[model samples]
Target chain A: MNPMIAAFLVLAGLTCASALAMAWTKNLLHAALAMFLCMLGLAGLYVMAYADVMAVAHLLIYVGGVLILILFGIMLTQNSRADQYETHNDLWTKQSGRFWALSISLSVFLGILFILNRSMSSFGMVSNEIQRSTKLTHVGLALLTEYSFAFELAGVFLLIALVGATYIAKHHE
Target chain B: MNDIPLSYFLIVSALLFSIGLSIMLLKRNMIFVLMGIELMLNAANLNLIAFSRQDDQIQGLVFSVFVLVIGVCEMSVALAIILQIYRHFKNIDLGAEKSRF
Candidate 1:
């Protein structure tokens, strides 16, 4: 009814639809595009959840960083062949048996739903705390003060991971 | 935005998580499976952000940041491993040589 709820609904639709599309499509490129849209919608959802800072960070990381890396993976691992139909090699991927995949995942989803429905009464068990404003100052202060050690460790881990990735990907035996 | 209930977000996240799981189960390409993993991770992140809206300590947000960092590391390392696998076998399909694994 209201704009806020409307926005939430729209973003949620976008995210879920794109995610479904990504799963449904066999074309790898189409899936990548769908993933892009999915990430964009997720950022909007974060905004709806009042985590604007998290939204921005997510947009930057997923869209700008992870996507490009995925594209690189798709490009690098493609099996090149001289056949006529081989051009689809990079764009398309094979699927495992569909029926079991669907049935298993659907059952798991139903189980999760059942659990969530049972737990709805328990959210009230926790003390509902005051909501914070959508400002970066508090986050910045906390990252620097309370979370400084973890932040530094994350940076170091990122560096090590990148370096290790490069070393592992090199043209060596 | 303020009027939105937490259950709605939870439902959406659950839906996404399920879809990603199916994708992971169904896809043969290693890259496609990786994409599914990313989708599931994003769904978990959304849940954290949604619940953290009502949290005072902002722990969920911080934890999600670390999650993001870890995701990036995983993607990089996995891709590198994939590249190596491609060089060795000329194919990146999961379980291509099932008897070996």
Candidate 2:
């Protein structure tokens, strides 16, 4: 087996296993830990896909930014008992009926598989040549040139979202 | 370097999306549901990156970047809303009882 395929398999396994762990756990903190591992594995998969920029950005945004936000959300929302000290956090979370969730997801997966199989032949390769060159420069240039307007819009949108989020989270009393 | 088929990526993403769907459906906690939404978004992003490999213009990559931005925006706003809901109800469970109040 080629090393590249081997690496891809390993990364995909890590990603999927951690994702499953996240789904299986009832503890919220355990789920958060699983999500961290899942995100790390996904970043590795992005690297294997030659998306180094995306890998780094994903690590930074999901790991650094989003995960922290989630952790904070968990902390701020919890109720404290009289006997509890700061050493521990109540992390157990409730879950609904597993039957419906499992059946729906399984059916969705099967449907997607059927569609992919039927349409496999229609997706002809656009180019046989693979560009192994680093996409950083190309992505930057394109974002500045062809996609400049959208790029600026995303930036402005991000600012608005952050400000709005802060406003929404404030004490309204 | 491109030995991997696009189908493999699609299959992985499909699996991810399914797991995410299940998470969203199964978890009663609001934060857990948000995590599921993030997983679904990431699965879609993975598909975009994989398909971008075949395109000379790499349009899919650029689109995925915007998707990432929008996803972050969604996360922040959703979490904030969840925070307010928790304050109002004193619980974040999706199916909390109104009789308790």
Among these predicted structures, which one has the highest lDDT?
A: 2
Q: State the lDDT of candidate 1 residue by residue for A35-154, as single tens digits.
A: 999999999999888889999999999999999999888888777767746544347788889999999889988988999999999887663853747747778888999999999999
lDDT of 1 at A47: 89
Runs off by more than 4 Å, candidate 2: B98-101
Off by over 4 Å in 1: A83-90, A127-132, B98-101
- Looking at model 2, residue A72 earns an lDDT score of 95
Model 2 alpha-carbon miss at residue A42, Å: 0.7
Candidate 2 on A1-173: residue-level lDDT in tens? 89989999999999999999989998899899999999999999888777889999999999999999999999898866677775764488989999999999999999999999999987774545666667999899999999999999999999999999999999899
TM-score of chain A of each: 0.92, 0.95
Number of the predicted model whose TM-score against the real structure is largest: 2
For model 1 the TM-score comes to 0.94
